[model samples]
Target: MITLLLADDNPRMLAALVQLLQREFVIVDALASGEEVLAKSDTVCPDIILLDISLGDLTAFQVSDQLRRRGCPSRIVFLSVHENPEFVRAAIEIGAFGYVFKSQISRDLVNALHAVAEGNQFFSNSET
Candidate 1:
């Protein structure tokens, strides 16, 4: 099974995303902060990460940059409520494989994950 690590400060959002994605992946962990992602991710090394942009202690962009610096192969997908182009550019610069707005979860979350899992990048139309 595909393994996933999720980082979101909101418990409800974490739970909901876990439920929505469980069928497609084995959730290694659902976390509330970017620190948690940095701590557990190296050991777990999940196949993909669904990372929230506004993680409590560290931002998702920082988390992604650190992981890349460490040569972590797992793909990072930025899951955010922000639709701003600046965030999109930052995520891309940090090598996030996907940028998904939380509002589009019902329609696009699964597809985005799939695309990222396949070593491809994905973003909403307005993101580019």
Candidate 2:
């Protein structure tokens, strides 16, 4: 099973995503902020990180950058409510394997995860 570390500022959505994916993935941990991602990632040593862009105390960009700087190898898949191409570009620049919008989670998140986990990148339905 794929090991995952999930971080989202929104409590409800965070919980819902965990509920949706936990059975399918070995969720190593969940966190509410970017700080937690940096702090707990070593212990979890996840295969992938599903990070919400607008973390409570830091942006996903910031958190991802920090992780990379610290030499964490976990692949990142960014989740956001934002659909801006600039945001997508930033995530791609940061080496995110996928960039998914919140509105599309029910329809796209699972597929996106599956694709990214298998070494394919899936930005969104609109990307292609």
Candidate 3:
């Protein structure tokens, strides 16, 4: 099973994500802040990271950069409510394997993760 580490600032959204993904993937941890994610990611060593784009304290882009600097091997997938083309461009620039919109999660998330796990890229929108 694919192992996932999730990070979102909203408790309700975090819980919803866990509930939605737990059956299909092994949720190593679900964190509510970027600091917690940075602190635990190395130890948890999840196969993929489902990170909220707008984390408090540090943006997901910042976290992703730090992770990459640390040579973390986990593939990144940004989950966001934002549909801005700029955000999608930023995710791709950071080398994220996938990007999923919160609104499109039910329709696209599982398939996105599957595609990413297979070493391909996926985006909820075709903006790229």
Candidate 4:
């Protein structure tokens, strides 16, 4: 089973995502902040990380940078409400495997996960 770590500041969003994804993936960990993600990542070693870009205290980009600097091999997927072209470009430039917008989660997230798991990039259509 694919392992996933989820990080989102909103408890509801986190819970909803967990519920939505748990059936398809093993939820290695679910965190409410980037700090928690950074703190727990080494222990969990998830195969994929679904990160909210607007995480409180530390942005997902910052967390991704830190994880990359530490040589974490998990594929990072930005799960955010922001659909700006700049954000999509930045995520791709940062080497993230995917970027799925909140509005398109139901339609795109599973496909994104599958694509990324296969060593491919998955960005929302609008972003591309």
Q: Which stretches of candidate 1 lie over 4 Å from their true place?
A: 126-128
Model 2, residue 121: C-alpha shift (Å):
0.9
Q: Rate the local accuracy (lDDT) of all candidates.
A: 0.88, 0.89, 0.91, 0.91
Clashing pairs in 2: none
Q: What is the C-alpha lDDT profile of model 4 across 19-48, one tens digit per residue?
A: 999899999889998989999877777889
Tens digits of per-residue lDDT for model 3, 42-118: 68778899899999889999999999998889999999999988999989999999889988988998899888888
lDDT of 2: 0.89
Question: Where is model 3 poorest over a 10-residue stretch in terms of lDDT?
Answer: 119-128
TM-score for each of the candidates: 0.94, 0.94, 0.95, 0.96
Instruction: Report the error of model 1 at residue 91, Å.
Output: 0.9
